[model samples]
Target: MLLVPAAHAQGPAPALPTAKPRPPAPAQPAADPAYEAARAAFEALPEAQRRAIQDSLVWTGDYNAVTAGTFGRRTYEGIVGWQRRQGVEPTGILTVRDRPALDAAGEAVRKSLRFTVQADPASGAVIGVPEKLLARKSPLPRGTRWQSTDGRVTLDTTSSPPGGTDLDALFERATAVTPERKVTYKVRKPDFLVVTGETPTGRFYIRHAAGADGIRGFTMSYDKTLTAEVDRLVIAVANSFSPFPNAAPAPEATPSATLSPGGARPGAGAPAPFAPPPLPGSVARPVATGLALGNGRVLTAAAALETCPSPLIGGAPARLTLRDPTGALALLEGGQHAQGAQPPAIRVEAPASGEALVVLGAEAKGAAVAPGTAGAGSVFAPLQPGAGGAPVLDRSGRLVGLVARFPATPRLIAGVMPPTSHALVPAGTIAAFLAQAGVAPGELAPAHPQGASLGAAAAPVLGSVVAISCGR
Candidate 1:
């Protein structure tokens, strides 16, 4: 009664007392000029080189973001952190002197981990794995499983068909608390789910995403003691995950010499060729196309050979016989084919700008073709990743050039998109290279009409193309 009387006397207590005003946040320190200069320098580097640097940072555990080549606040902070750890001024930039040491440190860790990207045939999923850490691999009911040597870490990849357990149901099961499992963090979205918590053995993390192919996901568990190491690895694995990569072609039976029309069969004394074993566990092997030069010889891009000194040509091991000084061409002396398979006619004349052309390559569906137009020294065409070393033929099927490089991945240039084009090695250069290697340039075929179908003109040469794969 006394309190009510006091409030009434004060006319509603002068309204509720207002909250005190918060002090203005301290002015943010100005950005360091050195940091700005370093960022500018990094951004000026080639995209591929920039990505390599980011990859190094990831291995060193200073970065947890995707190796996208694009720099951002996270990348700057990571650089600064690494600098501090190296007992250098925190410049937030990698100088020429700093790069060597950084690379060495990162390389050591990478070697120890033996990280590799693997394509899982069972679940049709591609992911990166620390092969050295997870040496034990086993088949699961729905997919594949990998475990560490001491059984302290484990990874499982699973897939479900459409109309199977929906995302909601899976999330429920993943997050449900059991007597031995404690749920800590959970998130559910329209097309994905994530659950993390503790288990009797250690901690666990699960991620699943819905796609047209249904659901694909992975679960990882490791001992608490490995949190620091495992956490960085988790970021890399997640960034490298591809639920559905391009479908690889099924293994095919070796073609007989008769398949090459107008080609001479090998002599009876010729050694029998054999296909290399399927890449260990279907790893993400580097692949390219090669042109057969008859007499057990082949020509392909030198870059592909750099990764795998002994590459497989048409699934058989090949020996490098010669490499062009420019590093754009390579010759292999093994992987025996039909003795006198007619090599595609090499036209010394380069294709004129805007000339219509056809590109031929060895693909999942045997020989594939794509229409293209010749530029000043390149070709504009929609090409796939392994298209390098493919043959570019004129409208009349005459060899015009070879695809030296694929189009670079798209990048923004001052907020503008750059033109997409692939590099082409002219037929003149190829002919000279062939002469230097002592290989005969085959005779030209009768020219087809300009209006003739490019695909028809390329038919004869398709048989000469072979798929080249290199493995770690």
Candidate 2:
């Protein structure tokens, strides 16, 4: 105790050790105005065009994220990466000059792969496949499957009804650490799940979505040796996947053959009965018109068949045989037709501008006709949604062209946008397409007497036009 008294005096001056202060966080880099401007320019493009650019980047091995067609940090980084590879300043902007080269490069790869977008007939899900790569296609019990020639790359699409396994179970099974699989990443959401991992000899990507129609998803696996070529493709395929295409119509709203005045053959009996209304979140069926090309062939707009897994022509199943490279027309084979129906004659010479024309179509209500005028290369008419592929006839009842469904391009008038108009595929183009398909169109006969009314001119071809309905 006495010794502690002397130490207490010295101990009072002693202070506890002090903790070191933390260093300040690193500063963020300043925003680049040029890069922002570049992004703005890219964002201004249409969604389809944006996705195309991203696809080009992926093909060039500069992008590895989803091709969502939306602007974000990942997209920006991809653009910058592409710019750097071109040996130019990395402004992250694609100039008009730069785009052509990039698109050409991408197109080459697509051509080699025979890339195409298709919907699974079983699940009604849309996805992109490299047709040349996956030369073999087979049916699954509840889905569809595709594989490469050597079976190194495989794709499988599957679905389950409402009372089937839940998402939790699926997630657990997909991510399970089996001896043959090693999951590297996984994500789960209320209505979807995505898992990526490596197999014993390859890599795999799985995606699934839940909805009123139940669960729908796909799995893609590719050999490890081809990772350089397939890694980016996985992102593209995923982006294009649509578990439930929004364009699909409700069962009840599907247009029946009877809806078209000309759809019923001479004696096809009563129209098919309609189903109950579709469940919540269903859309109207996409409808279009088609022209009867004799011998079980039909011609229609290709756009209407974009997401259709099973296309119906006048309530009969049909197969698409050929498509116009210009994306304006498609030829369907094996469609049913009335007996002794004569296809309309085709006029090779285009109509002069301002010439009166008649547009014939099988509309929702019935067979209908509208007056039009020939422009430089298109027929100008007040066309409706299902008017595509309607026959455009001359005063002599000769086929001049077919209505084409083009996206409504907005135009500025006095700083205001107005409704857009529709155009048609000219006779010359249609003739060339027919020739390529080895179908000789009927030659035009002697001209009819002058001054024939539009209604009278269209009468001969009314029954030849039929409505086209597609189911997803």
Candidate 3:
């Protein structure tokens, strides 16, 4: 049975209108003392502070309020809304007492963004970092390097040359970090040098200093999609970058700072180990969402695949293969444990802007659905960390896209950056990829079988969704 178009879906028809429009309410009296005092306190804040407050509100999804330092009705309403969320009275005013809560909220955001200072006493390297974004800091031949767990961000500092190398040599070594990178910026001076470029996978920025102290510098490589935060991070990292007093290069290490043919530092290209810290009470932990494609195949996020050599889908072991970086998607083959698996078929058509869509995946307990609206190029949905690589389906249960998690652009939400959000890769991209690999994806589930409701049509597909993992 075919499902009726949403425009004509059956429902109770409304009776003829009989009531007249109500009159507008009378204007309220002057602002209360509390509100007035709050406004004064807010107005006293410096421009930057006001902007920070505005940014915090924006992170809470206040598209109506402007970040300008001026206090207005919109900003007041936003503050009231936020206060209500905090279980506080909607006073529409920020009291000095609110400072603690506000700061705590900001700190939470910072923690979410993984913003923390990394100080290596041994390497004499101290730098600011997004801790949540990076893992496994290790001593490099010259200094130290920290790679993002997902392989999207990298930061490394090279040892100081007791007397910095000449500008020419520094320039050569810096540019060679990523040979194929497209140089976006270059500067050469007698004592300082910098080079920036973009690679197929991401972008890299290199800074070198030469003087009596020798060459002490660091490079930042990150995913291009995070350009906004990248700029700010670059600035922050550089400003905070310093070597402790008497900091000197470690004894002769690796002779060269050159990268391996793979464009990663030695022993740094591979993903980290798959052993996630045991959950509280020694329980197991789910790694990522996996889309069961049937016929002994499943799909999951590329990041999850990176660290797991032997991943499990629905308690069935699977082998990882096929990775698309541009699409941020991964495919796994072999999952014989799941019974009655039925993967949704690809729609082969893009969703219209503002169209309602459903994102399916298994997060923690079992399968879940995240409702989303189609955006210009992707579907915007509220997503959790592990929902990457889930199938995105239209109202009729046709596969329109795949979910991907990308590092959100860095912005001060409170004190930290926003958590990564999910976006849907259109079906055409997936189809083209499958075509290139000579593998056909799952077929679209039959729509409205037995006059089933949308929820019913979605159940089987969700049943095929699994929480993937890598554990002993």
What's the CA error at residue 80 for candidate 1, in Å?
Answer: 1.8
TM-score of each: 0.44, 0.46, 0.36
What tens digits encode model 2's per-residue C-alpha lDDT throughout 177-271? Answer: 78888975554333455667887788888877655566778888989998877775676677667777753332332222222211112222211
Each model's number of backbone clashes? 0, 0, 9
Give the per-residue lDDT digits (tens) of candidate 3, residues 1-472. Answer: 0000011122343332232332343444565676676678787887778767765654443313224456655567778888888888888776677655775675576567687777665445566776666776887877887887777778887755453344445555554534666755443322344566778767777766543344556788888787655554564455445544343433321212221111112222111111111222222345677776545556665654444566765455665556654535666665453433555677887888977676665544455444456876676654444556777778677778777543322322212112224566668777766655455666545544433333444555766777776656
- Residue pairs clashing, model 1: none
Candidate 3 segments exceeding 4 Å error: 1-283, 303-310, 315-317, 324-327, 406-421, 436-454
Instruction: Tell me the spans in candidate 2 whose CA falls farther than 4 Å from its real position.
Output: 1-27, 246-472
Instruction: Specify the poorest-scoring 10-residue window by lDDT in model 1.
Output: 1-10
Candidate 2: 10-residue stretch with minimal lDDT: 1-10
Which tens-of-lDDT digit does each residue in 152-240 have in candidate 1? Answer: 98989998866575655675588677899996544333345456678776888787765546677788888988877887777667656
Global CA lDDT computed for model 2: 0.63
